[model samples]
Target: MEKRLLGVIDATAFHEGLQELTLHRSPAAIPFGGRYRLIDFVLSNMVNSGIQSVAIFPKYQYRSLMDHLGSGRNWDLNRKRDGLFFFPSPRLDHPVTGVGPLDHFAANIDFFKRSEQEYTLITNACTIFNTHFFPVLEWHIASGCDITAIRKGGVSLGMYLLKTSLLRELIETRHETGYLSVRDAATDPNSPLSLCSYPYEGYAAMIDSVDTYFSASMDLFEPEVWNQLFPRERPILTKVKDEPPTRYAREAYVHNTMVANGGLIEGTVENSIIARGVKIGKGAVVRNCIIMQKSKIEENCIVEGAILDKDVKVERGAHIKASGKKPYVVRKGTVQGAWMNS
Candidate 1:
């Protein structure tokens, strides 16, 4: 087990262009694949690698996030001490506003000061990839680096390991100055922070926008992507839901689709991810779509190239058309069948 260590899930910035999917939930808590949340990838990695304690910093629309994460029992961090911790925004005292990296840490100063953990593993909640942090920690230890970050394509996944004492010094000593763009500052030659980068050779997807989210969602269709993400060696953990196997009627036609448990398919579905408990009524045609949990498509409806949020109900005999450039989306729990377009 990776003892004397802590995890930080930084979701202090709003992810743009997610539309209805992020209306009432943080992007991290947004559903992915057939049944997992976007945050599950990171959380699963943390637990899989034997790191127990974690503190999640939620930004906007965190209600659903709270519900999903609960007590973090799914990840098995529900211990008597040094378990899962939820830190609200520092601005929660006054009014709602944007949170910077400095403020983000300042709010949870106690976590840094009081935790027995020597090393802090900081990471963003939206980057999806399975990884073991122990090796990264070993690398940081061997290199004597002040900060070790995992990067792919010039973007730091925020998965970094640094001495807790160093992080505390940066916050308390530099209290007057703000370091929101720490990534930019890390690249400065004059900066004293000894930074190192670790190359990630795996399926890494940053779901910050609808375009990337759609692209990554579609990528799950590929055999290579699916195998690497949900490989036999490492299993992604999430909140448990005992849903029965998906039932497809005799006339139902599904091709190259991934339907999760409790789904009832009675129509034609092609090249889509149908999440848990979705109901595709008879004569409906769903193609190139991501229908999230518990959404219903009534009889004879034609849905193509769209993303439907949780509990959305598309009525009978309606036609909703979207494209890769612009996907038509129905907001969460909003009854919008033929209501509008993207």
Candidate 2:
């Protein structure tokens, strides 16, 4: 059954609310959980589910995403037979919409036609969850539904499972059917196709805005949430770099924070998520913050309830604070000087 499934990810989403982060890359490539990209969760889930063939359709800025996923080797998807496939959209003017836009899929229709998979699992690239699709396949098959929409608490999770033949039909007749994407066909109440809902009880979070992203990042501090998403049996995979273990100074004090590899901590940190290769200089206080890779918070700086993107620098004695729910976002590779504290 796993061999019959093909995983398709739509990585073209551009959320206006997350423009600060998406200015340089697609939302799918946004860093998350200190060490993983947003696409890692779903991509890893597909690989873990024994789906050998996976295709990603991306648009807008996707260089970072391609770099992070590189040959799909970390996930063991670099195969000569059926492995990772990348199709970039040619329609630059096409509006970015929900999962599996028929227009985008139509651009690479030949790949779909040549594939041997009987069923296709379509999903968005930015949702965070840890679950296999085998059970959903069983439910769809048993229910005799043409499409199964994976839901949690009656809300669509932007995941769909349907026959490959039906998907091709929808793509071919999208203009006539008035369905712009697979999400459209599966979600429309007046559609003629049979639809089923599969309720997933596990924890799921969709990152559509800075607030939601911050909330989800902070949630990792909870043991239950962390355990559910990072279970040993089905671990979330990411690009691995052989960086030295994080180094901590004797004066450094940390509690309730998730710090990634190759970081140097020399300050007081609490309830934050610090990504790879970050540095917190002596006497700095970072609380309730999300600091991305290689960001440096220099001496005596006080940062609270903020998100510093990769390569950001905070000059000495700078004070940055904002609401935890709505974090103050510092864009990638920017600098925060002491004067900005005014």
Candidate 3:
């Protein structure tokens, strides 16, 4: 079979909290687990699955994403038939707005229409996990699904596999009003037309048209429209278990070297990850904490269950306890919990 064209959508803002160290770069460019960029996981997954053609949709703060991706050479995506593409934001003359994923779908309709492939894979860049999308694609085709969305339990990872023809038709049929932010329109009831009120009703409409919708949450497409379209259990629902309990945040870093002058390293680190250029002063104990680059942990300080961002300085004799989705940083003797800059 001819390989299907795959497009990865890395729709994450670099400015999200605790993302400054990596935000100056795209989230995709943020360093993770010691060496690999977050984008590497997704791109590696795509390549390993045999999906040849890929395009990255980068929004603002994409300079780092571009610099790292660099013609997709690392992923071996620099070939003529199997090259990577960077889809820049549409120009003002083109005048596209509210350009969410679906809008990106509408905007790039031509790419799908002209491609020889029958299917497309769309995914986000926020989460860190390894997946073999070929199985999902196989499931999508074998089940005769027009659209298949991949979801994990509790959190929606924002991945989807769909038929190019069906997606194109949906975009065309919906026309200019095809896309809208659910958060924005949901907040304002007076908003003219939500994606809910559109020709397809909602995401379920598209999924129901298919044979199945797979998600870690069994009722992945359990939209209010479920009643309008089909009976309960009408659509084949499948649950995908977490491959290895996908974990994020800074706690993942521990026991790694931080390069810098006067870098004091005194800790018991085993299989832990750390960033570059961090200084652990003498008599300071760092156990299982992610220390970002250029952070200074002063002497006699005990840092346990904590994550420090770049340039954060811990005072002498200060103690830290980590408890929250956010990272902990000490700024000028004041300890506070905040999102780290990428």
Best by lDDT: 2
What lDDT does candidate 3 reach at residue 104? 54
User: How many pairs of residues in model 3 come into backbone collision?
Assistant: 17
Error of 1 at 142 (Å): 1.4
TM-score of 2: 0.98
lDDT of each: 0.81, 0.92, 0.50
Residue lDDT tens for model 2, 38-61:
999999999999998999999989
Candidate 1: clashing residue pairs, number: 0
Q: Which residue runs of candidate 1 sit more than 4 Å off their true CA positions?
A: 92-100, 181-185, 338-341
Return the TM-score for candidate 3, rounded to 2 decimals: 0.61
Candidate 3 residue 256 C-alpha distance from true site, Å:
11
Residue-level lDDT of model 1, residues 199-274, one tens digit each, is 7888899887888888999999888888888877678999999889999999999999989999899999999999
lDDT of 3: 0.50
Off by over 4 Å in 3: 12-23, 90-100, 105-110, 153-155, 180-272, 277-279, 294-301, 311-326, 329-342
Candidate 1, position 30, lDDT: 88
Q: Sorted on TM-score, highest at the top, how do the candidates line up?
A: 2, 1, 3
Tens digit per residue, CA lDDT, model 3, 1-342: 237756656443333343434435555565444334556656776776676788787766688678777877667778987578887556323332321244555576677677777787766655444555666777767776555556543233556666666556556755454343212222244534221211111232111100111111113223433332223322211111123221222322333332223233553333234555555655666764556555776666767645565567777767775555333433322343323231
The stretch of ten residues in a row with the least summed lDDT in candidate 2 is 333-342
103: Cα error in model 2, Å: 0.5
Between candidates 1 and 2, the lDDT winner = 2
Local error of candidate 3 at 108, Å? 4.4
Every model's TM-score: 0.93, 0.98, 0.61
